[model samples]
Target: MALYRGTGSGRLSRGLLLLLWVTLGSKLCPTGAIVQGANTSLAVPQNWTAHESATPDNKSQLPQFTLDDHYWLFAHFCWINFTIWMNNVTGAQLCDWRIISRPYSYLQYCLESAAEKLKFGYPNRIADDYIFKSHYIYFLNCTQDHPVLLDPPEDMLLALIIAPICLIPFLVTLVVCKSKDGKTQS
Candidate 1:
């Protein structure tokens, strides 16, 4: 039986092939693999101001962050990253944990504060008890202007997804040509 026939049938075949390719492609190349060197930076948009600056003097007074809080934030970050990758969103999104510098050190400061509060194996009291959680939320809400840079492993995995899509045309051509050759031989 012939695979592709008239133009209408050929279109239908291509569409079905595309659908199959996507389905198989996703199964073959899953996302969120957590490959190392998937480094991305978070950028604070202009006109956005942090509620308070974390300074050396106040480092001893920041509230503590619980294990659950850390876990929740980690999950949130993963979900956001997954969404960005899945949607292939253009431009950068917020990734506060990736920010390691001062002035915009939302995540770094929060973690340092958490560590400080846990000194001597005991949680310390602070002026604002909810400081850690608040800052965590704030950083989560920050925006990233730069795109996520995928490392070699991640690049190859992503290429696996695209390579098949790109080969669709060549694959269909090969199939059609084979059918034509068979007909001629017959």
Candidate 2:
């Protein structure tokens, strides 16, 4: 869901720049200018009917979701992420990333931590939640000069679909960057 409008030379340059902007923008900003992290304690409404509504803090043990619920949870997760991305239109209406990054990050953090049971560990959900948030900022910064085409998946494939799509872009970017470096040296 990380698509952006870029300003560069050709279509390839603009695409390469935007591809980088959406993919690496989260990692590039240590201050997290793009998206803020979520507060896992309790930022979302506790309604069971809504998107993964349940606190991880129980009296006896840590929060845990039923395995049967995972499929449904995953479905909702994908749906909500898609909804947010769809609303994330880019260009002239784009907002400043510095000003409006944290809330999205927070929402993302809350969602992943609650749904995926991740409190403190590797950032496996970075691509899932963080990237979406990054794309949000990128979209907000869009202009007439930089129109964008964002393709977000809308199916039950969830991680199966997401993992491969994310990797393809990274691999392509890697090869492109290496080739650019090689040409520069020549």
Candidate 3:
């Protein structure tokens, strides 16, 4: 009876630990950063409707860009490109076009320029600044006055990677704890 009780407790503890691992792992996973690029059928936001209406040809209006939004956009691009390079997706093409390619062109120069103009990192401990406006190209130097633009927060990528790693130790600890309980019961 005592052995059975110990085994049951061990199993319960292991199950609980697994649950905790999954919960923590999920919290760390990249949730919002992933985007489906081919989904042009997505509903346009209301703010975009005003710009669309103003541009009769649909070519004159600049695409509205936000720093956080662009960061995720670039992150998605990087993810897609990495996947393509790994041959996970079929018909993925890697090309080098100057400043007008689909994703790269939109992010590389234009956004940086706008950030500089807006003084995104000026007069502050601006660790980094990234701009993603559609039609501007800018770059700001890293200084006490100028904010850094290239580096993003640790959470941006670390959470996506580290959270999973952290789970491994957590799982191992739980398993060891459970197994010890089982052996002691026998």
Candidate 4:
């Protein structure tokens, strides 16, 4: 039977096709491009004053966050530079483990402080810490005023479960498309 009828059944077929296209589009969406050669000072928001204004080595004293705005951001940076590619460390070498570790530890400390403030519910430390430091790393990494999404444990678990499922369907689509094209040509 025809997959796309010309009536109500056709509408259902169209909807499914549309949904498949949407899912595929979302999966293929590209991230923002790196700003090149444009006086790119680090884009940390000015309000995030929680960090220690010391040398890079002294960054350990920062009240850094654990997710540090998600380990993925750092991993993304790493892959953009020197992972499974040509061996020169040219692009962005800012994500060295030593550099990324301290501020994260500091964010943990800050989070603990916020948690203590939040434990009482309303008018407390969480709001108090919101001055600058609380969202420092988050704003630093995000583009424009968009909120940074931290990867919580659940996200990792969900990704682990969903990645293969998404891939299998895409692979199946490719095979089916190829089969249809082959049959039509022959």
Largest TM-score belongs to which candidate?
Answer: 2
RMSD of 1: 29.0
- Tens-digit lDDT track for model 1 on 1-186? 123223455634643564344323323222323212113322211222222443447754233445543433333333233322323222243343343233234333443454455441223223122234434533445555787776668778899889999999999999898998666663
Q: Model 2: per-residue lDDT, tens digit, 62-133?
A: 233344334233323433443343454445434655544653555455555655553333344433544455
Writing each residue's lDDT as its tens digit, candidate 4 over 43-143 gives 22222233335444786644343433223222222222211121222334334445444444444444444344434333333333332432352334434
Error of 1 at 85 (Å): 2.4
> TM-scores of the models, in the given order?
0.20, 0.25, 0.21, 0.18
Global CA lDDT of candidate 1, please?
Answer: 0.39
Q: What lDDT does the true structure give each of the candidates?
A: 0.39, 0.42, 0.37, 0.39
Error of 4 at 78 (Å): 26
The predicted structure with the larger lDDT, 1 or 3, is 1
The most accurate candidate by lDDT is: 2
Task: Please rank every candidate by lDDT, starting with the best.
Answer: 2, 1, 4, 3
| Candidates ranked, most accurate by TM-score first | 2, 3, 1, 4
Cα deviation of 138, candidate 1, in Å: 26
Over 4 Å off, model 2: 1-90, 93-95, 115-122, 125-186
| lDDT for predicted candidate 3 compared with the true structure | 0.37
> Cα RMSDs of all predictions?
29.0, 24.3, 29.6, 30.3
- Candidate 4, pairs of clashing residues: 48-132, 63-106, 63-107, 64-103, 64-106, 64-107, 65-107
The clash count for each model shown is 0, 10, 7, 7
Q: Which of 2 and 4 is the better model by TM-score?
A: 2
lDDT of 2: 0.42
- Candidate 2's error at 102, in angstroms? 4.1
